[model samples]
Target: MDNVSWWAVASALAAGCLGLSVPGLLATLPLRLRPLPRLALAAPASLALIGCVGVIDGLLHLRFHWSHVLIAAAVIAAVLWPIREKRPLWSCPRLSALLPVTASAVSSVAFALVLLHQVPSFDLFSQSYDNLFHLNATQSILETGNASSLQLRTLINTDRTLSTYPAGWHTAAAMICQITGVSIGVAFNALAIAVVSVAWLPGIAWLTSLVVPQRQRTAGLCASLLLGTAFGFFPYALLIWGVLYPTFLAYALFPSGLALAMLLAHVWLPRWAPAVSDQVRPWAWNDRWMLLGLAAVWWLGAFFTHPRSLVSMVLLIVPLVLWICARAIAVAWKAGGARRRRMLWWLGGAFAFVSVAAVAAILVVFRVFHVASRPVGDHLNGPQAQAVQTVWDGLWQVLTQNALVGLGLDMTGSLIILAVVVLTGLVIALRRADLRWMVVAYALIAVLFALAAGSNSDMTKILTGLWYKDRYRLSALLPLLGVPLATLAVLRIAALTRWPRVVALGSATIVAASGWAGLWAPVGAAAAHEYRLENVKTTDFVDSRQIAFMQQVADVVPADQLLLGDPWDGSGLSWLYADRRPVFPHLNGQWDPDRLLIAQHLDQIESDPAVCTALRHLNVHYLLVSTGEFDGGDPSGNKFAAIDAAVSQGLFTPVLSDGESALLRIDQCS
Candidate 1:
């Protein structure tokens, strides 16, 4: 069969397997329970198993041995075994009551996957180092037959190993790769789509169900759909998936953490039932245990999958823990002796389980990887730096110009609006003023975390300190907490108006529309591709003329020779020539003083005659410079002008020049 047919078969197989497994997993839950609740419990466990297996295989390089398979089976059995011990079944309100929530969850996942698949895949560029490290680690684990001493890096110039990414995401990708025998690209794509559908969507749905009243369930469902769609389907989501696939995988686990936190919060509060109401009694011990287990899975998944997201989770958890503590205290204060004792038991059990799981995750990350909490520095350049400068401007632009109409159907603006609407709705719905105050506090924490992490400073230091900054804006996941509250607020507002239902429905519609518009922009008919990366082909697409000239130089250079150039140019060229490793590829967050020294010396060798002579002694093959691109408009004003001048004055021979980039070969003394 042709490659196309092979890929088609693989795609079909992946879809079929996931479709069967997901539904079966979901079906295992008590049928009487709300769909969201079942998903909230099941999705995280499934994703955790998937991720753990992947990290083991990808980072540890463990083979798909029978032992590994047995471990996975054991994990699955452990999670599912509890379901077999049947308890008295309680009746829920109705399946019809959950249709809106279920539909919204399903629709959000479906839309995200469809949109993601429709986009063309791009060659992994600068971020491929992370992928390579993960791949290498997983391979090493398999080869050595040792999981415990699975060092992530082979070469360590820095204090941290180059492969020191969180093990969870790599393991998940590795497992998927092992199962499918597909390339990393396909494995990541499958995992990314599944992570959202299974973990994120369901988590959002469950959070909404727990908080929103039955009467206002539709609005809550709508709000969730708005937030999930806006956040999960943004352009950045696609960009991250295309370039930094693992980070995208980590992002998939983000929603699950929030869901777990919210689930725990609900258990603590046990919303009051009216005297006349016939709703079931507050959640039981078994239910609380189940939520705790699910929470544990999410928290573990967050830490393991992406260290960066772990930072974000740390930021979120502080307020969450405080809220839980306050609720427990309030319950104990108001309750009679026996009831107070029971509340204490519940609080202790929940906190102990959560605390243990958190500590275990920390030990795994720190002890296993030997990662230290260090101060931030130069690694803070590029998109993050740009993001810091533009964040305030972007926020202002969204609020003033497009608050009502919304910045038409693009991911970034839509996400900002979704966060705003959800927060507004939640604030309005607070039955207790204290709850409102807690929400405000959490929101403040999230904003502060985002500002610090995304700023022009070291994200790692901020994240190491905060822990929650790891996932960046994943605190946006908390906006989901406000979803239920917002629904009630809408209903309450509508009640004061003549056409209550219309006002509520209309308001929801406007919010959803605005969100959808912001995330899914209309592409021009003549646009080359629907997705940004798809517009350019990997085989040939030059963003800069200098890049094209550099490629030409690469064509003439021998495979074994080293060519030095600027950091940005070197990165793109290295990716293009599969066999070549640039003297310094753009730092992959693993660089230290030594690596920095190497990079600086390499730069010096490329530009300075004395340095070039020394580099030749060390066996440097060629020096490449793009005088035109480097100099604003005049080649003479370029940073490499001295090198160009020296080469002209018989210091080196210019072998090639396309009026853009130039290649110089140093003459050796015989």
Candidate 2:
């Protein structure tokens, strides 16, 4: 990478930490959470702020800048200040508290190192299908200054009708780009790294600490290590598989969301509910309305980022909800000694009514997200296609610590060790009532993963269809609570050991290594490092040679000129990197008639008047033609066959050329 590229990546990483973290910390000021919980919750709050900023600018039709984020954050903090508790949100933590913080930092470094290994360059992007939309959408937000989720689908929608999309993730990328002046690609990679480290690593660490009995000083450290490195399927798997940017981010911050749910479930019901007033209560929060206000901020964040996170929240939080309801029922039973039958009926009626309301709310959410319209990918096989069976398959995978995604990382030794760890956790959950709800939550998501991954039944579609029956999406949701259970289990095992610190550190190292390469690999660290290095040593997408050539193309191709080529052939990226618009800016879409006509008959420009007319109408001034395409990624050439023929006939003059790719001026079109 050149110095400019290096600067872009470094600046993005640095600026992203401040831009992403501060807004959230300020936003959480009014909420009655401890400093630790507040710190953990900041990521989600920052996401909410960014999402709102994007939507606000979209409505105002103005360019986004660093000022917007800071100004909005300032406004939010100032407004919330009067209502803020006299108890400050931040204070120096005890030296002992820094154990979790230290674990968070060390674990964050490990997580980042692996991710940096996976995506080696800031310029690297997924060669997959969805990323084309993501890249184009991000560029559109940066260029047009419209970041509204409702309007983002217009980039591919053609008719300008409002199409639903979760633009928060894409918007954040654009924010990074504008703030740091980095290309969309680098900005994206930098933001992903930042989210994992600044947002996810600490969030999971705090959640794990919360799950442990507080006296278990090592809970945060163990949780950070276990959750960050012990598992390959999540936090890492999601990054590889769709590059699943939106889902990855939402799920990353989802621990905080889950933490919030746990907080409300444990504290709100018992303390604030009128029926439970007679019960022992201990929380500074006297107002139920204030708690709901905190939830509203999280909702706004989740809603804009991805509605699926909300559904994921509901899925995981159900067990807790049930637990809370069960407690309410018991409380009503005690209070209803005299009119027990009448009180029981009232309680039952309330439960039934709430259940119906929840169902209705879920349906509304599904409709808003256009869940029914999304494709389920039944034709395309996933990681679940092989090495697994349908019924209870996801359940089995979780229990055994099996990886569903391709790129084999499984080892017998690692499997045995992890299996014992996870199963011990499950066994522990069964005995501990407080942790039982987490197990329930993990099981529910796993069941969904199974149905999505293996089943093709009508019922499967109905049940998992909310995720469009995409196993990757379901699999990503599985680890939200799964890691915490694993963390608790490691803590339990450490308690039984003579050298708990050594055991904890060693276990953390071995498990993280197991996920990367193998447990017993030669000199544990060396093997894991070599394995990660080999995977990212060479990327399958566009290379530095191609990037250099593209930069040259950008110099020659004027901003006003439009390039025409197949998106599948990689010509669509001209818009993102070169600032030269492409006639086809994405891989596949319900394209307008003009673009389709040109795609079908661009070579017939001299013979076909319609082709000539379309070319002129669309302002075709250049052509980006790749002579050879990516392995298995090449288009059929049926659509671009015209352009290939035109170039073969020497109809256009090459402005520049790299071995198989070139930028040509469109004199032939006339």
Encode model 1's per-residue lDDT on 1-670: one tens digit a residue.
0122446335633652353135335434443344455555454454455445544664655544323534674656666766654655445657555545565655455444434433434222212223434434444333343222223443222345434445444455455545555544455545555555555556665555545556655655555554454433322333342234445555555545655565565665544311111124556678777667666666655555555656555555666566556665676769869878887888789899999998887766454334565324533333222333333543343332222111112223334544565556655645553345336544554455345334544434333333322323433334334444445555566668887656776665565555555545421110113223222223222234544565576576777665654432233244333324444333233554433443444334445456545454445566665432211222223333344455446555689887645777756421
List, residue by residue over 1-670, the lDDT tens digit for candidate 2: 4433666777988876766688888766675666666667777778788877877787787776657877888888888788777875667778767666666666666666655553445565666557778988898887778887878887777656777788878878887887778877677777877787767776776666666655464653555544565465566666665557887888777777776666665565654221211112356656456656667777787787778656767777778777766666676677777557776787889889999998996787556545578543332243433224565755677667664543232322335566666677778877876667767777787777777666676557667656766776676766566666766677777778987666765666565555545322322332233222122213233445555566677777667767787665667777866787777776666667777778777777777788877777878878887644433444434555666677788877788887657888877556
* TM per prediction: 0.60, 0.84
Residue 89 local lDDT, model 2: 62
Runs in model 1 with CA error above 4 Å? Answer: 1-35, 54-61, 64-71, 78-83, 87-102, 105-150, 153-163, 171-193, 231-255, 265-282, 323-424, 431-434, 445-478, 481-510, 522-670
Against the reference, the lDDT scores of all candidates come to 0.47, 0.67
Best by TM-score: 2
lDDT for residue 227 in candidate 2, whole number 0-100:
54
